[model samples]
Target: MKLRSLFAVAALALLVQVSMVAAAPVVRENGAFSCTFYNDGETESWTGTPGNVDWSDAQIASVMRAMDTIAGLFSNEASRKVNVSFVYVNQTIGTAASAVPLMSTESSPPYAPKTKTVWTADDLGGRGVASGSAASVNNLEDVWKYGHYLPSDYADVVVTISSALHLNNSLYYGASASGIQGFQFDMETVILHEMAHPLGFYAPGRSDSKTALEVLTSVKSYAGSIDPKFFDGTTTVAYLQKHGMGILDYPYAAYETNDMASLGVEMSKDGSHISKWVGYKDILMGDMALSGVVRRNYSDLELAMFKDMGWSLANDPFVAVPEPSSVILSLFGLSGLLLRRRRTA
Candidate 1:
């Protein structure tokens, strides 16, 4: 009788462990407890609810294939790797569906204590959503929140598709399969560039402000005839620290052309670190190229950064994402990572 009782207890414990491992929070809007997505199309985000994937197996397979394509980008030629925890959410939700959750109380996060933040412009304030041009939806306000959701911990790369991403004069559509190929790299390149920012790829002296317009102006200026400098450290960093966390924004460790030239990457003829690797034509001083995945599969830099954050890129599962900015500040072997660009040839 004693042996039988022990076996029963062991079985119960195993079952509990399995439930905890596979447990995705049940989303319940009317009840009380729930999970949340920062925006629509966030991987399978649920509120006091669990996701329902009873879709045609074909759709599920396509989504999984898309995920695989994204995962392959981590192994980039530049050796910048990508390590992340996968959070799933729906591409859209009706008014009656439910809101996403966010834990805002922990002085330091990753501890929600059950509280969640819904995906809305009122809170996050258009951090990732695009503005200006015909794609502008700000006038609608609520319509703007329909963009893809980024998780609290964030991912090395965020690939979202939705009705909101129409190529109607929006800055995000330049590289989309629907628009002009940015006259340079494909849409994949831009996606890779954005991913590199959160992963700490640009030079350490990057700006963290919403200077997309400003940078565009500079790029235009340079295109016309002058030497345009769009970003500097203080400008963006100061703003981000004020709004979000400092390390959470850009310039934490940008790996600009100068930063990499010393590593024998061949920057440019002029000593200006204003570009890095644009697409294929100009490897300017400030331009960002393949991280590490501008797409080479994955990058060592990415693996190292993730490892610094206490997670192994190769050994870890896809669901173990750490805080986005947690390990970005870690100083890797300070080799030519900080060298000054010199006019050579």
Candidate 2:
């Protein structure tokens, strides 16, 4: 009898394992997260770049993983998919007083050269802690900035990264976790954040090659109605990120709208970066930072919240139905009746 029961239990466990693996839906190489790798080593060698423009295989995988994480969350939470493509470049990079590369190849729609601007962060008015809490907006001139110059053929959104940033063997950065003592940035997090910028996650945008319009839109997105999801655990952010799930199809929201909640992100002093501001209290992982380095926050309420967002939050879909109030009431009433009978007896 014991042997039979053990065998049955083993079979059940195997079945459960298979079900769980099958349910999560593996990410394929060709789908929404279809990433393109680039190397910024041609000009510098900080992490793993051998030359000024080459990337090692390990560096490529790290960024892809970070994209996968955010993508996975959106996929699971919003029940949709986001197609992502990446670009690696070694444009003039440095701190605040940075070098801006003016290349003819960078001239195009949405890509602008923001070489002549200096930005400072301040409050919306005379205010409190909330003012410093978000990133200040930097004006990006598509006519003058490089975002428009980026090759847009076969690209919906493009993500660029640093070669040193992806190599964690020494300074180790990227998404895996704490890096070797050398690097401070996370490659995966950066990809996730930057990718969000173009997909309408951070702001609404237009494909206009017109510099004035995109700059205006980017500034607006930083402080605009941060998707309540970024602000809190509202279902809206997930819904926006994942619009198509299983056979169900959801319409994509406009790429530029405050409809998504946020902590108010703006550009850095150089206008080269944008995200939830740093050097302040760390925003939760999932919370959208003004910089490209964080993820959507998570808490115990995560499962319940995703369910409300319309994603299947059940551990076992067939068995995950909520408890019926009627059943509970019946059980309580029956217990009370039995207690009364005993007292009378």
Question: For this target, which candidate reaches the highest TM-score against the unseen true structure?
Answer: 2
Segments in model 1 whose C-alpha atoms lie over 4 Å from true places: 1-165, 168-296, 300-311, 315-345
Q: Which lDDT values do the candidates have, in the order given?
A: 0.29, 0.35
How well is each residue in 150-206 modelled by candidate 1, as lDDT tens digits? 233322223332222222222222222444434222334333333333332222122
- Name the lDDT value of residue 120 in candidate 2: 20
Give the C-alpha miss distance for residue 62 in model 1, angstroms: 7.1
Estimate the overall C-alpha local distance difference test score of candidate 1.
0.29
The ten-residue window of minimal lDDT in model 1 covers 135-144
Q: How many residue pairs clash in each candidate at the backbone level?
A: 64, 48
RMSD of 2: 20.8
User: What are the per-model C-alpha RMSD values against the true structure?
Assistant: 19.9, 20.8
Residue lDDT tens for model 2, 1-345: 999999999999999998554122112353234444433322221122223334555666676565555444433222123333343444323210111212122345443322323212111111112211222221211211112333333333434444333332321334446432432444554454454333222322222221111222233332334431122222322332343211012122443643443322333332323333332233332333233333333332233233332233225122234469978988999999999999999
